[model samples]
Target: MPDQDTSDIADIEADIHAHLAEIAEIDAVAVRVYQLRVAHPTDLVAQLAERAGLQVAEVARAERHLARLGLLQPSPGGGWVAVNPESAAESLLAPVEQDILERRITMAATREQLHALSGDYLEARGMRSAKGSIEIVKDLGNIRSVIDDLARTCASSIEVLSPGGGQNEEAMRAALPLDLDVLGRGVRLRMLLQHSARGHRATAQYVETIVAAGAEVRCTGVLPSRMLIYDRHCAVLPVDPEHTGVGVALIRDTSVMGFLGRLFAHYWRTAEDFLADPECDEAAPPEEVGGELRGIERDVLLLMAAGKTNEAIALQLGISRRSVSRLVGRLMDRLGATNRFQAGARAARLGWLASVPPA
Candidate 1:
């Protein structure tokens, strides 16, 4: 009786192995079936044979066997449809079979290593690296992909230097909310725009929405360029004139990113606060005059009051010294003051130098 029992156990193991092999064969057939279903759902036997790498006669025999087992249904017109078994059976086995086939394909690809070879050749030859990643894309589709990826990956901060009214108001509106969601989770955001951006209704609305959501927005006159920096780790620059497409360089190297971060800071420092409404040039009461100073000029006044020179102020604010001098002249005219000293004195008296919490 014990010998008989051992015999039965060996037979069971053999049957299990045989069933596994059959399933492997069926998995190959399933892949063919999927392709056939896509290309010619009406022609089953040919597709199945092509997929199985078997003769048409052999595939027909296998199909008949599968149909007898109710694993496939024959159509009156032609071809066959898979009749999936109980979910439990498929769930238990199909995934393993599918995974095995995928690994096989991946192995085949790895053996050839065509993609990796191209990437390596590009890196080794240094041709791809020299162009700077942002310049490499040179297409709209690639730009969109890079921007979308950056938006998805940003963890803490996103700084944008946009000129000419900034990324189409509609696109900005859609993207800003996603960035705001990240900011809501404690990420910091800083945006710089061309002063001309103020003239556009879409940009104004976008600025208001972002500022209201607690992101910082600044504007500079005649901004020279556009950029988007994500987490201080990657920077994007527009390659196309229309700015519809851009090139992105992912700066993972700490030194490179640090340099880029400083550049962004330089721009941010000089940018005007967009949260505050600019006061109309028409004269108003002292209260209103102080309110107008609440914008970028007010910050400039405070910096000047600190006894910083025009060059120093320009460096700190990320604008040209000429711009600072221009600002100083405007403030002097506005406050009816003679020099920087008197400008500070008048700004203090008018309460313009008080630290305006970043709106």
Candidate 2:
């Protein structure tokens, strides 16, 4: 048997190793919880747990662990609250502990890749350049920090291609202060958004606010790709949809950034200016608009309300039956109605049909 001191040290080391493994798992969970809180802070813990696929018991455990680490606290009235990093010095792990935790993370990634690929070949191929680093951060807080840092360090301009509306409205709101600070210091901001995004209240508000604060906003029906470029020095791309807890590649190489910048310019040239008053009846002729019901979504709503079946609407509009069905379903969901009649009534009550006169 080992000596008492040696045996004690060995046991402690084993405990540390075990704790390191748990830390990695906890990090992933914490990130997911942070994102949930950012997006839906008013949601109860039970709802958040359900969305995260964690049992209530598991959520309770995680809550306790986070509180103990000083990363979270109970809200004054109810629910758990996140402790901002500015007020979280006590939560910072010791240097040795951090090293051990980081090592465990690297080991976990290595093990996962090795198991999946059955060799080191894929891992080697996937290793990115340290000069131009690519890191996948599953934490929303970390992603926000990275964006802020890039925005601060940008020299000239920042161009963004935003999609899917404002996924993290709170985070975007929080980022306003930082954006204003950057603009105050003379950085130019340019954004390209999907035309449909203007229909989302949160997105429209944010776009208007940013533009009013000196940022340029442009709209386009052709913008399907999401991108963010900083001073033509770095480009950030979403590795995941929902635009939360995703990886961003910080490219410093001029050649790579230049290529991305070219792609951005190409898209920009084809995009429409949101600030410019749209020309009336330019895209579709006035006579053809109502007949085809292509751009006349309101006409489809009206037809659906008239109790016409999908096949009948298709025949009347000279379009595919599938298109009519899809349009009706979309309109119903948009109006938050259970049936065609309810949808039509809701649309009328909301004055959407009245707002857009029949062509």
Candidate 3:
């Protein structure tokens, strides 16, 4: 053989050694048959097939593979013997390793070429192409991609006006992936949840979950529409808040997006925080706010009925007079009474006092 040919064969042997373990584990039937032959090195083909779990043809294939890898070479006389494994290891493995490296290099170069082509394509298309764009998305599947793309590209903040009770199970399941993505990217998320959302079981739970994940959420009595704005660059809103059967509007006009952002900010400040207070759990009984008769509302009512001043009640409860005053206002509103006297009378008339008994 020529000097170059000897060097080339040596290179091939090196790559085969690098990936010998990989080829050995490709298939179960093949591996089992090979292992059987390896364990009983001098066994004849017929006896090996009988002893191995694989079919006759499979054992024959395994034998061919072993011989091709230089692990099973013909003996000096007649049969075969297992060659030195160290000699065979690289001899069989190098070719596979070379093929993998070649393919990886080709794939990486192709990907880079494609990315450069894409950049040229985008440049010709224009970066601020959305200036006057009003894309109509009818399919929910297509809308999901649009939202996901915006979340991935958003640089600064994500503002959302999520109204109409809480999100349905289907919406939660679908949006969770993108929602988590934006939050994890260090984007400031300000969500405006409508007051009606507090009544929703899933919505409340979802709020608690996202709040724990570093999202800012607040509830209000009214919201303009269901919208998601990413960094004042674009906004997505249902064409009609009452109906999504029509389609959704993806607006890229700077003025429209700016207005959407302002609306979100205005509501964010005015809306109430999504509290994790024990009083807020919907699973608790209707009468129990935080604890049975342990609620500030009930305590305030009892104190008011006894003609105790807000300051006196505050001192006894170890709370501020301002809190006691606020509790009085809330108690009156919840009881549908006009004043503290009326609130206390209503509580007594409703058997709230008797339900607790002397403590």
> How do all models score by TM-score?
0.43, 0.43, 0.43
Question: In model 2, how large is the Cα lDDT of residue 118?
Answer: 29
Candidate 1 accuracy as lDDT: 0.60
Worst 10 contiguous positions by lDDT, candidate 1: 84-93
Residue-level error in angstroms, candidate 2, position 87: 62
| lDDT, candidate 3, at 170 | 81
Please say which candidate is ahead in TM-score: 2 or 3.
3
lDDT of 2 by residue, 1-359 (tens): 13754665456456434433443344556666766765776778799899999887867777777666455777887887787632332233344345445655765676566556523542453475655544444466777788888888888998888764433578678878877887788899888875455555787777777788898877654344578888887777765434435555455656778788887775566556555533232233333422322233555564454345667656554445666667676666666555443454456555554432211
Question: Whole-model lDDT, candidate 2?
Answer: 0.60
Task: Superpose all Cα atoms of candidate 2 onto the true structure and report the RMSD in Å to 1 decimal.
Answer: 23.2
lDDT of 3 by residue, 1-359 (tens): 24755566567545433333334333555556556766787777778888875567878887677677576778776556666544564455445546546655765676666755643554554555667566667787887778888888998888888766667878887777777777888888888765446657887777778788888887654565788888888888886567864667778877777777777776665455666342332233335432334344444565555446677766654446776777676666666655443454456656554332111
Clashing pairs in 1: 134-247, 269-317, 270-317
Q: What TM-score quantifies how close candidate 1 is to the native fold?
A: 0.43
Write down the RMSD of all candidates, one decimal each.
31.2, 23.2, 29.3
True-vs-predicted CA distance for residue 346, candidate 3, Å:
25
Clash pairs of candidate 2? none
Summarize candidate 1's per-residue lDDT along 177-274 as a digit string, tens digits.
67678778777888887654665777788778878888898875444467778887677765433544544434444566677788777657666676
97, model 1: CA deviation in Å? 74
